[model samples]
Target: MRNSYRIALAGNPNTGKSTLFNALTGLRQHTGNWAGKTIALAEGTVEHKGKTFQLIDLPGTYSLFSNSIDEEVARNYIVFEKPDVTLVVLDATSLERNFNLALQVLEMTTNVIVCINLIDIAEKQGIKINERILTKRLGVPVIKLSARNKIGFPLLLDTIDRLVTGAIECQPIPTVYQDHIEEEIKKMEPRVSAIIGDRLSARWVSLRLLDGDEKLLQEITKRLGEGRE
Candidate 1:
């Protein structure tokens, strides 16, 4: 039986993502640079119900479009590595802006759980988040907690356990684009799916190609070439 699962933690800058990572992994975590890249990543592990989860703290970025090296590393890790679960941390006080990254993550993978951190501060500021509405709208589980106060950690851990054990199912909502853009995606999706071959999200890849993401294209070509060798 598989007792270990890979989980990726991603979010925008200053969303308390690193704090949550440290809280969950404690002294078990380590920081290291990704292969051949100056950018560093933090990794750690947590045990829940006799199962182990290896968590990788990805560099914070606003979007996964790969506009910079940080975005590129985070994007490639999620799209290529295909972690067992992706915990997208969002700031409850600034959820409107944070949704940009969360939505992109849903578009890329269905194995996702949205975490609204810093809820206590948001409440003090008179900001409220209806996680139920978010879950219904996004078609994935939504959780709220204060990573700093260590509140909601139990539910968060249980949620992760259910997701990893297949006790919960995620049906990520698809991102709707303008009609013309959707038409272009439709034209390219099949071909992109063929090329990617279950390794990544074809629709997401097609969108990047349309946007002239040469880096992603180069990486895909390199990977495909390597596969053929």
Candidate 2:
């Protein structure tokens, strides 16, 4: 049997996410509708250092809040399917706006790597990114990449390998809310944890519940029902 691990690629649209996917997968990619959903999801395989990494390219969304079907699909996969590693790609020139999704993923999973893509364009635009500072702030690995030129490709793959092999560890920083919201989350977290049973971050789920995410609540109910059956 071949050693294989699943990696999810997530990012906002127009962040060159598909470009990176194409470059990495290189003729080993396919697209199909996500299970029970009309949204299309891309899948491919990459071989690095004797391990097969199955890359699932999730739909591009500005947030995993599930405001749309695309967002719902992406969020469900990350929260439920639980890939070995999630590559959160971002535009190097627009880090602030891109960070919304990144932070959300960090809340949902610790197996994350933030890739600042389009470094070449950012350099031309006189934008500088300090990956070290970003890594420190986000509490996860950060990589500067120019996928079009294959810059940082080797390091990215090596990092993935190290992470999957337990040579490197990721400790993602979860978002902290205000006092009232934090209190509410504190009250609800244990209940959510009891229902999910370590399947997801209870605090994050509690936050979503407080935000009035009825869809997520329904998903949790549906999943639990399915489990019982």
In model 1, where do residues sit more than 4 Å from their true spots?
Answer: none
Per-residue error (Å), model 2, residue 170: 0.9
Q: Which ten-residue region of model 2 has the weakest summed lDDT?
A: 171-180
lDDT by residue (21-58, candidate 1, tens digit) is: 99999999999899989999799999999999999999
* Cand. 2 Cα-lDDT: 0.93
* lDDT score for residue 50 of model 2: 95
> Can you write out model 2's per-residue Cα lDDT over 1-229, one digit (the tens) per residue?
4479999999999999999999999999999899888988799999999999999999999999968999999999999889999999999999999999999999999989999999999999999899999998899999999999999999999999999988989988767788999999999988889888987899889989989999999998998888899
Q: Assess every candidate by TM-score.
A: 0.97, 0.97
Which pairs, if any, clash in model 1?
Answer: none
Error of 2 at 24 (Å): 0.1
Give the 10-residue window scoring lowest on summed lDDT in candidate 1.
Answer: 193-202
